[model samples]
Target: MSETTPQNPVFPHPAATLILLRDGPDGLEVLVMERHAGLRFAPGATVFPGGRLEAADHHPLWRAHWPEGEPPADLAHRVAALRECVEECGLLPTCAPLSSAVLADLRRGLAAGEGFAAALARVGVAPALDRMTVLARWITPEMLPRRFDTLFFLVMAPRGQEPVCDGGEAVGVLWATPRRLLAEEESGRRRLVFATRMTLLRLAGCADMAAALACAAVPGQGLPAPILPRLVETAAGPVFRIPAGCGFLPLETSAQTVRLG
Candidate 1:
């Protein structure tokens, strides 16, 4: 469905995405992929690896795979994030190191319709869910026909593993510092949706992964409030306005320039 199409509002599907980060020679770098231009949602926009949650993500079997602590309210979101990361980018965050050959085989299995949990079981590994940190939560504006309540998770990229775009949902993948990405967007070399642009702006404040994680884990800093942008008509044109003090500066943008899927 077209995001701009006005229809009866529906509950936003729960979704999760991973923001893979690492310390590059220049500084902090994040992994992003270009969605296939033919896709129904967020077509051709640069985005983190993610998708709507699946039934498998919430299966009780997952209880054996996560950590020991009281499971977070968003534990299933983290599971979905890791699963999507593997499906879209060919990277797995496991509790133990996996050989490149094993990773490739798992990717092939997933492509051939293997369930994520089953694949993990075959490999005798569990997802390193403890490594993930909540970054942000956003709900698609109600004006859109298709909407998602998506959680953004941050984690350091697992060492000894490389990312490969699946060439279907994700057509290309790259690692670049947030500043570089923002610069590319400014030059029109890349297309970033409103949430992605704002996310990058937030990440741009950190010099490296450690700082970013520390910022996310500050004491008593609870999960961020869900941000639901509003579409407003100004004399200039339509613009999307997010609430103030959401950590993203200059909270308004021309609607024509923002991709809402």
Candidate 2:
């Protein structure tokens, strides 16, 4: 192991990521955003919309707006996923009707430090937490300075809801099949972090939105333990090894060698 590699890993902060899906002309498409080049982590790489869970997300006020009966342990993560989806992509999945004006107002409220529940109240909407399908869990390797235990959620894009990148945290957006994204990155036209690469590999198994949703909903599919890669030294270089049979296809190659920002 390298000198910098930790002998004992630090606890990872809890985080969530959203995978927005839609049926495009070709097939099932996933929404991806390019992080700002200046970002401290995952700079200039494509990622799903998500961030760390905050204490504010656990406030009981949010439960009044989140009717989906997700386990309490998962409630904060799901809420955080929804909040990030709206902030980063301008796509809000809610029970109440949402207009451009309402969305604008919600954005303004969010900027003013109003929480998700309060923002939803301004628009007379409740978060459709059921829309989100828990997908997978991944924990950053301990060697990294910053680590996160991230929950991945997948949801179908609401009809007529156009995704607009805010040009801040996210600089650009693309709605493409997982296979296409992998190919583009391999061809050197785009960049992907390790988590994103694994996510795309899993999503590539589905042919369309229905298939994707069905696959995600399959019983016990999302219950595998969080992926924690182990650094292994090799003659070529240091390589991270993810365990085999952890729900997704086994990665035969070292994940550390994968292109990451």
* Candidate topping lDDT: 1
Tens-digit per-residue lDDT, 106-212, candidate 2: 87788688988877876787777766777778998887768899988888887767788878999998799999999998898888988898888888988898888
* Tens digit per residue, CA lDDT, model 1, 1-261: 112435677789999989999999999999999999999888999999999999888987777765685666777888999989998999987788988888888888888999988888787767898789988888898887788999898999999999999999999999999999999989999989888988898899999999888766332234568888878777777788888976666677888888776
Query: Could you tell me every candidate's TM-score relative to the true structure?
Result: 0.92, 0.90
User: How much is 159 displaced in model 1, in angstroms?
Assistant: 0.3
Give the winner by TM-score. 1
* Every candidate's lDDT: 0.86, 0.80
Candidate 2 Cα RMSD after full superposition onto the native fold (Å): 2.8
Which regions of candidate 2 are displaced past 4 Å? 1-5, 68-72, 217-224, 234-238, 259-261
